[model samples]
Target: MRARGLALKPYWSALQSSIVSGDDRMLFPPFGNFLVLPSVSPLYVPEDAKPSQEDLQAARGVIMSEAQAFAAEIRSAFVANLVEAHNGARTLDSPLEDVDKLMRLVTSAVPCPSGAYCSTSATFPAILDHFKVCSSAALTASSVSTSPMRVLAIQRVLAAVNEVEPGKVDAAKTLTAELYALGNEAFHCEACLPQQAAVGPAAWSNAHSTKMGWTKMVHHLLVRHTMLGQTLPTVIYTPLKPPSDSGDAAATAETASGGFVVEDAES
Candidate 1:
C-alpha cells in the first residue's frame, strides 16, 4: 500500500522533516564506524510471556550477541579506515560481509525512533523504509559539511550500502524470513504451534549467528561497492607527495646552479 511497497510509517516523522527541509543534515550518521544501540527494535516478546527461564535467557543472549556483533562492525571499520589512511586502499576478500557489518554499525548507533517497525522480516515496505531512513540520515549528515565533494562521496557510499539490487536481495529476503520466523516460533506464536515446534538453545544461537553472518556479508558488499564508487581521483588537482624537501631547497638549488652558495663544513 505504501509507495514503492515500503511500509514507511516507521520513519514518517524523520522522513517528513527531511523532505520539508530538503534534507540538510549530515545524513551518513558518523560513517557507522562503531556499533551502538540497535535502531531496529527486537521482536515483540512480552515481558509477561510465559516462556521458560531458559527461553528468556536465550532471547536475551541473542540480543546481547547481536549488540556485540554490531560493536565489532564499528571496530572493524575503524581499523579499515586506519589501514586505508596508511596503505591507501585494500579490498576485502569478502565484501558482502563488510556491508552487513556497516549496516549493523550504523543501525546500532543511530537508534531509530520507536515508531519504526523493528523486525528483520523482508516486509518489503519495511525494508524500503529502512533505506529511506538511512538515506535521509546520510543526507542530513552530508549537508553540513563545508566540503561538498566529501558530502556527495559519502552520500554515494551510503546509497550503495542501502541499494539492495534486484536478484541479489533474495538472500537478504531469506534472512529476514529466518529472523522473523525464529522470533515467531520462539517468542510470539502460541496458536497453531507444532507440538514439537521448539528449538534448542544451541540451535537458536546458531540461527542467530547465521542471520548475523549473512547480514554482515551483505552489509559489507554494499560498503565495498559504495567505497568503490567513492574512489576519488588520484594525483589530479591534488599534488603528488610534495618534494622530499621543501625547506630552503630553492637556495640549495641556486647554489648548485650558479656555484655561489657555500656548502656546510659538516657536509
Candidate 2:
C-alpha cells in the first residue's frame, strides 16, 4: 500500500534506512525510532511517569536530530524539483498544486516547532518576469495569516529564486508578507493569542516567535548582506515548552533547541 505512493519513496527510504534492528517500527514518519503500538499505546504518563528532566532532554535531542535529518531530505528534494521546474522543464498544469503536494511531504518529514510549517501556497513564473504578480497575491494572503512558517517558506523560495537569478531580493519582502498573510489565514487563531485559547497554544506561541525570527533573519540577509548559509533560520524552529498543567502536559517539556544552532545559512 505504501509503495503506491511513489512520491513518498524518499521518506520510506529514509525511514527504512534508519532502522538498525528488527525492533524498529513506525510511530510517525519523522520519528528516529519507534516501538510497537502496544508498547506506548496510552501515549501518556501521570506526573510520576514523566521521565527525569535529563532523560527528557536527551530524548528531545534525539527526536530533534532525527527531525532535522528528515527535513533535510525533503528540503533537498523539494529544491531540486523546483530548480528542475524553473529550468523550463515540462509544465505542471497546476504548479501551485504540486507545490502543495511537496509541502505535505515537508510536513510529514519534520517535527516543525513553529506549528505553522511552511506557506502552503506559491506560484512560479519564468525567471525573467517580475515576481510581483504571484508575490503580491501571496503577500495579500499572508497579511491576515498567522503562521510564520508560511512566511518563512515564501522567504526561502524567494531566496532560492534569487540564488538562481540574482536581484530577486529587490521585491522579496513584499513576497514574504504575502506568504505570511496566506499562512495567517490558514493557521492563525486570533482567539487563542496571549494564552487565551485552549488549543495548540504552544504551537501558536512558537509560530509567532519563529515568524519574528525569520523576519529579522531575512532582513539581515537581504539588506545587511549577511553571509548566506546553507540553511534557513526557519529550519531550526524550536517550540517553547507549555506549562505542565496545560492539556499539552503529556508532551515532553524539555527544551527543543536541538536545531536552533547551525552553520550560517545565508551562503
Candidate 3:
C-alpha cells in the first residue's frame, strides 16, 4: 500500500533522488523520517485492536482510492493553473517581497526561552526556505512555458505550513481549495476552452490575489505569535542514521546530540 501511494506521483521519486544525492540544500529534515498524523481523528487505530483480514482489506481499498483521487486532483489543478497563468496577460510572480519581510520578522522575533516549545522557530525558517524555492521554481516554469513545477512547489509550501499550524491560516486553505476546484472544473466541463484558450484571466486573478492574501495572513500570525511569546508542544529531534560501515557496522551507532536531542521541527 505504501509503495502504491508513492507510485501515484513523480514528485516523491524526484524528492527521493534529491535526498540520496544530497544535491539540494533545501531538502532538509529528510523526507520519510517525518511522519505526522493527526492526534485526534477517525483514522486512528487502537494498538491492541486486532482487525480481521476483510476489515483490513476494506481499509486498504478506501485509502488507496482516496490517494488516487487526490493525485488526480493535484494533476488537474496543476494543469489548469499553469495554463491560466502562462497564457494570461499578467505574469504570475510569487510574492517575494512579502516573503522577505516575513523572513526578517522571524529573524528578529525573540527565541524561545530555556524550556519552551518555540513553534515559530521550529516551522517558520523551513517554510521560508520553501517559499523561496517555490518562487524560484515558479519563475523558471514561467520562462519555459511548459513546466508544471510551480504547482508542485506551491503545494509543498502549503503542505509544510499546514502540517505545523493547521487552521491558523484559513486563507491559505481557501486558496488550496480554489485551485483544486478550478482544475477539477476545467477537466469535467465540456464548455471549457481548448488548451491555448483555456486561460481564464478572472480565475487566475482571483487565485493570485488569494495567494498574496494568504501570505500576509501567515506573516500576521507570526507577528502575533512573536509578540505574545507563545509556544507550542515541544518536539524532540532524532538524529539521522550514519552510513553503513563495511566492517564494524555495529560501531557506527547513533548518538544523542548534546546529551539530549531537541531541535526545532522542520518540514
Candidate 4:
C-alpha cells in the first residue's frame, strides 16, 4: 500500500494542479482545451470566454470524485487478490476434524524411539510416540523439559486451524463485499473535465453539439492519459525536407545531419 501511494504521487500532483488551477491540461494534456461536437469540424473555445466559477468548481469536484472512485476500485481488486492467495494456501480438510485425529494419535499407544528426536529422520508414528511419552512425563514432573517433537506437532495442528478457520473467511468476505460496493459507486463516473467547463460559452451555444459530448470528452481524456503513461518507443529521427534555396541548402543539410535525439520516456 505504501508503494502504491508512492507510485501515485505524480497522478495526485496532477489532479491537485487541475483542481487548483481549474485547468485540466495538467491531467489531460492533449484534449484539455477541446470539446466533443456532433459536426465534422472540432469545437474550439475562444480565449476571451473563460469558464464560469461554478463550472470550474463542478469540473474539479467531478474529476476528484472519479479519481477517488477509481482508486477505490483498484484497492478492492488488490484486496480480493490477497484474500484469494490466503485462501488458496489452506487445505480443504476441516481443522476440527484434523485436531480430533491428532489428539487421538497422540494418546494412543506407540513405540517410543531411544535417541533424541530428529525432524528429518522421524516419521509421523515416531513423532506421535515421542509426543505421547514426553507429554505424559511433563504432566507429572514439572522439572521435565518440554519436548521439541511435542511442540512441533502442536504447532502444525494449530497452523492448520489458523489458516482454515471459518471466522477468517467470513471476515475476508465482509471486507471484500464492502470494497466491491465501493467499486460499484464509481462504475459510471469518469476522470475528465465536465462538458460545461471543457466547452466555453462559444461552443456551448453552438447547435451542432449533442448530448454525447461528455462521453466523448471522457474517452478523449482516457486516451490521452493512456498515451502519457506509456513509455515512448524508440524511432529513427527523420529530418524534414529543406527549403528550396541554393545558399540555404548546404546549411540545412548540415543541421539536419545531426545524430538521433533520444526522447524521454517519462511524461
Candidate 5:
C-alpha cells in the first residue's frame, strides 16, 4: 500500500531513501528498539506515561534530526518533481492551469511535512512566479486577507483531531502553525527562514513532545488529508493569496517546526 502510493509522488523515492533511519543527531532514547514497530493510536509510547529527563532530551535530539531528514528529503523530492513537471509541460497536452494540480497530486503521495499544502485552500502559483505576482498584486491596491496565515489543510485536520480526541488538537494546531510560519518564510519570503530555530521549540526543547510523538503527528496529518477512496485526486482548492510585503526577505530569523507514526512511548 505504501509503495503504491509513493510511486505517484515524483519525489518520494529520494525523501524515503534518505529516511532509512532516524538521524542520530536527534536520536531519541529508545524505549526498546523494536524489530518492528507496532501500529496503534499511540504507537510510540504507552498512554499516560511521563517521559523522564533523559527521555525528553533524547526525544528532542531524535525529533530534531528526524525533522531535518524529512525536510531535506522533501526539498529534494519537490525539486526533482518540479523540474520534471517543467520539462513535461512542453510535451504534455495539459494547459498552464493544470500545473498546480499536477504538483499537488505528486506531493500528496508522500507522507512528509511538505505534503501539508496539498490539502490547502491557498493558491500558490508557480513559486517562480511569486515575486512577479507580489509586485502586481501590490500595485493594484487590492486588499490582502486579514486572516491568520495557517496551513489550510492541516488546520482542518487539526480541527478534526480536536473533535475526536480529548486533548490532542490544540498543541498540534499550535505546532503546525509554527511550522507553517517558518516554512512559508523560508520558501516564500525574501529572507529565508531559520529552519533550525523554527523546529527547536515545539520539537527539540518542548518537554511534552516525545520521540514517538513526533512520528505520530506526521502520520496523522497525512492520513487525515487522504481521500476516502484511498487514491490521489485532483485537489479542489480555494485560493488564499499571500501578502506582498513578506517578499522582502528580512524576516527569516525566527520560526517553528516532526514524524511518520506515533510510537508506544509517545502516548
Candidate 6:
C-alpha cells in the first residue's frame, strides 16, 4: 500500500527529477493552470481505448460552453479592474491574496515529499497529486466517473489564479479560452476515456467494477483533520459614495427652500 493511502505513481518520473532540485516543472506541467483545469496529458490514454466519435463531439460542446462562461467572468473582472483604476482604488489584489492562501491550504493538506509551503521541486507535484487523488477518490466513492463536466469545473478554478498575476490582468479571459481549446484537444485525444458510469454504489460495483476499483485505489488518501484546519476570514464589502460637492449642496438646499433649482450644465 502507498503511504497515507495516496498513490504517487502517475507522477513518478516528474517527481523524481525535481526531488533533488526542488523545481516545480513537473508539478505544474507546461500548459498552465493546475487546479481548475490541469493541462491534459497526451500519454494518459491509450489508442485502443479511445472514446467514441459521439463522445468526443459531446465533450467539445461542453468544453466550449465552459469557455464562454469563463470568458464572461474574466470580462467582468477586467471591467471591475478598470473601474477601480479610474476611481483611485486598488484592484483585486486583496481577493487574489485570499485565493493564493486557499491554494496553499489545499497544497499543504497532504504529506508531501517536501515540507508544506517550502521551496522544493517536489512541492508543486505534491499539490497536483493532492488534488488529483482527492478529486478522483471523491468521484469514485459516488460512483461518478470523471467526465467532461468535471473537466470544466476544474478549469473554471484557474480563473482565481489568473486574476492575480502581476502583469496578466487580462489572463483570466484569455487563458480561459485557451483552456477550453486545450481541454477540447485533450479530451478528444486517445488518452482521455469517456465517462460511462452513473452515480451510485450499484453502478460502480457492477458496471464499473474493474475501473472503479483501480481508479479509487490509485487516487485514495486518508487526509488528517489537522491538514485542513485553517479558517478563512470573512470578507464584507461596504459601498462608499463620494460626498456631494459644496456647490451641489448649496443648490440642493436652495431647491428645498424653493429659491433655486439645479440644472444640468449642458441644459
Strongest candidate by TM-score: 2
> What is the Cα-based TM-score of model 4?
0.19
Q: Please, what is the TM-score per model?
A: 0.19, 0.24, 0.21, 0.19, 0.23, 0.19
Per candidate, the number of residue pairs that clash is 29, 18, 0, 0, 23, 8
Better model by lDDT, 3 or 6?
3
lDDT of 6 at 261: 19
For residues 76-143, write the lDDT of model 3, one tens digit per residue: 44344444433341223552234323222211121212222322211222332333322222111112
Q: What is the lDDT of residue 98 in candidate 6?
A: 36
**Candidate 4 clash figure, as a count:** 0
Best by lDDT: 2
Model 4: per-residue lDDT, tens digit, 1-267? Answer: 333223333433444455443212222211111121111011113333344445444455555655444334433343343233223423223432332233222211111222223111111222322333232221111111223222222223223223433232221122211112211111121223354347764675334232221112222223343353342211111112222322544333322412111111121
lDDT of 5 by residue, 137-206 (tens): 1111111111111122333334433443334335212333222332221211111124444666656533
lDDT of 2 by residue, 99-184 (tens): 43443321112111212322122222111011211121211111221123333443453454344335523331333223222121
Give the lowest summed-lDDT range of ten residues in model 1: 233-242
Q: Which stretches of candidate 4 lie over 4 Å from their true place?
A: 1-56, 91-267
Every model: Cα RMSD to truth: 27.8, 19.8, 22.9, 33.9, 21.3, 27.0
**Between the candidate structures 3 and 5, which one is better when assessed by TM-score?**
5
- Find the 10 residues in a row with the least total lDDT in model 2: 125-134
lDDT for each candidate structure:
0.28, 0.30, 0.28, 0.27, 0.29, 0.26
Position 119, candidate 2: lDDT: 16
Error of 6 at 128 (Å): 24
